[model samples]
Target: MYKNGLKRIIDFICSLCALIILSPVLIILIVFGTIFMGGNPFFTQPRPGKNEKIFNLVKFRTMDNRKNKNGELLPDEVRLNQYGRFLRNTSLDELPELINILKGDMAVIGPRPQLVRDMVFMTDEQRKRHTVRPGLSGLAQVNGRNVITWEDKLKWDLKYIENITFLGDVSLILQTIGKVFKRADINREGTASDIDFGVYLLGKGEVSREEYNRKQAEAKELLKRR
Candidate 1:
């Protein structure tokens, strides 16, 4: 029923309507983001979508492109400016993902797409979140978002895919609205973004530092082709 096909229909209709209704906000974000974010107003990255497919997930760029002495991009905290913080806190930065939903790269609700690096670290069981389209807002997001442990996040994602229903999606959507209004769990502890899954695994002794480095390198190489 809903999971098989109806959900995609609703996601498309809702996102199309949302794009129309939110056009003004999107335009303003683009104008201001371009001005304050140095150049590019949008942040795009290769995210793992359904069945581990890669897609360019789009959002407003919240961090400036700053590099250290070695020309490596600075850490997220340093690059995250006040404007970026505002966008993050309000979740206005995510508005551009309507385009993703519109294009069928995502859904209005489902398991959120994670970084390619994160995807590589996922077990085969956990990666099953991709059985459905990625989401703009997801079960894991409303539960605890970036503050939740990766283990719990993956658990919720797996739970969502087991049985999706119209009522369930609506409930999650409503819960997501409330979470956004409260600006709850937007970031983990004091950081500007969630800790990388690969980093988390390294800390938990699940993966050796060498393995982490190697897999991260692989993810970077994959991004180059995207």
Candidate 2:
């Protein structure tokens, strides 16, 4: 009872206070993101929320609109300019998600939302992460962020979903504060700070025992190196 009721109270109070306190920073981010990205200050994308519901997740635009040969977009690292990189490194890009929390599309603390494409790839057990509303800062984000593999992040998300509580959320939120200050796991080596779920999926094989084995082996090696 306390878990359900207290959690909602915490969400309401904290979100309201945060929005008020951070309004100035939020406005600045909006203007900067818009000017940098050319039109849309906000980047909106469909992400799976609680119970697999689709919601528009919003973030500040942190990448420029520079494309490459054949008019296709260049890699994120290439397009991420200095200002964009600053927003990402400080996690200022996530400021727009306060609107999501206000609209009931997210919670202040829960498993971070996954893209719809990535959600489609979730295993049956992994899908349990969707049982609660997504969050701006989750267990996975605070623990490892881009430093951890997708599989490990998913496992952490699932574990958090299974053990969610008022105290757990508070603890996770506090820990996230520490991570932000420390700027841990901001990016992977040789890659941009942000991840494109679509591109990541395309590189993996979804079928055949041999394909599965190969992917698993590669994932293991990456994990060992990390």
Candidate 3:
């Protein structure tokens, strides 16, 4: 009952309330991000939602648009300024996603959305993560976030889909709160930060460099249309 209906009601109410309560913080971030990032305050992009449907995912812009001499964007680590790092570390950048939940494009608990381009690389089983609305926090996020491997993250996402319940969602929400407060598993080892899924797959030889580059270009083009 909750999975099919009541959960969405709860999500709508909670997200609405959160947006109201957090309006000040949101306003502050909007102003700060606009000043620091020198552009839009929000980062909006097309991400796959339930059943691979596409929607524009919104979040606070945490990185500056720094480009190199050739006009290519700088590396994430380079573009991510100190304030951006703080927003990421504290999960404050995610606050704007409450609007997504309110709009029915997301849930408070479910599988986190991945890049639309990344969808092409997912195995059939992994694609099951999109069976439900994408979430602000999910099983993979609570368990290991970006620190875990792609395989494990997909497994956790599928597990959540297979076993979603009102109590289960509540438990995951509480656990997510704990994880955020502790700021655990923010990054992987032997690196300055978490690696992108495409990079990870490339390292594992699952995707050729050419394919990854092509997919990246396609993603950029798609985002441009948005």
Candidate 4:
């Protein structure tokens, strides 16, 4: 009962209240973002949501759009400034997702949405994570977050899906808050961001370079539908 219905109703109410309560913090971040991030404070990306549906996921911008002399964007490590790290470490970068939650594009808790390219590479069993709305903080998040391997992340996600309940979600939420307060598990082992699924697979020799490129083309074509 809670998994199929009560979850969304509670998610809506909680996200609405969270937005109302956190408005001041949001405004402060916006001002600081203008000064430090150079302009826009929000980042939007097309992500696969429930049932692999595409939606733009919103979050506070944690990387500047700095470009090299050639006019192309610089590497991600170069663009992720100190302010960005602070936002990421404290999990404040996720504040804007309350809007996504309120808008019904996400849930307060579920599997974190991955890139469209990542979606295309997923096996049908792994793709089951999309059976519910993506989330702001999830089992994978609280369980080791970006520090965990891609396989472990999906493993936890499936575990959560197998047993979503009101009490279970509440427990995860509490664990998330504690983890955030401790500033734990923000970035992966050696990278500033989580590793992309496609890249991970290619690195592990699970897919050939040719297959990777082909699937990327497939993902791009699907993305064009929006």
Question: Lowest summed lDDT over 10 consecutive residues: which window, candidate 3?
Answer: 187-196
Better of 1 and 2 by lDDT: 1
lDDT of each: 0.91, 0.79, 0.89, 0.92
Return whichever of 1 and 4 wins on lDDT. Answer: 4
Of the two candidates 2 and 4, the one with more favorable lDDT, higher being better, is 4
TM-score of 4: 0.98
Ranking by TM-score: 4, 1, 3, 2
Worst 10 residues of 1 by lDDT: 217-226
Per-prediction TM-score to the true structure, in the order listed: 0.95, 0.84, 0.91, 0.98
Candidate 2: regions farther than 4 A off: 68-70, 193-226
Clash tally, candidates in order: 0, 0, 0, 0
Q: Give every collision pair in model 2.
A: none
RMSD of each: 1.5, 7.0, 2.2, 0.8
TM-score of 1: 0.95
Top candidate (lDDT): 4
Candidate 4 local lDDT, residue 114: 94
- Which candidate number has the best TM-score? 4
Cα lDDT tens digits, model 4, 55-164, are 99988999999998999998888999999989998999999999899989999999999999998888899999999999998999999998888889999998888989
Off by over 4 Å in 3: 190-193, 209-226
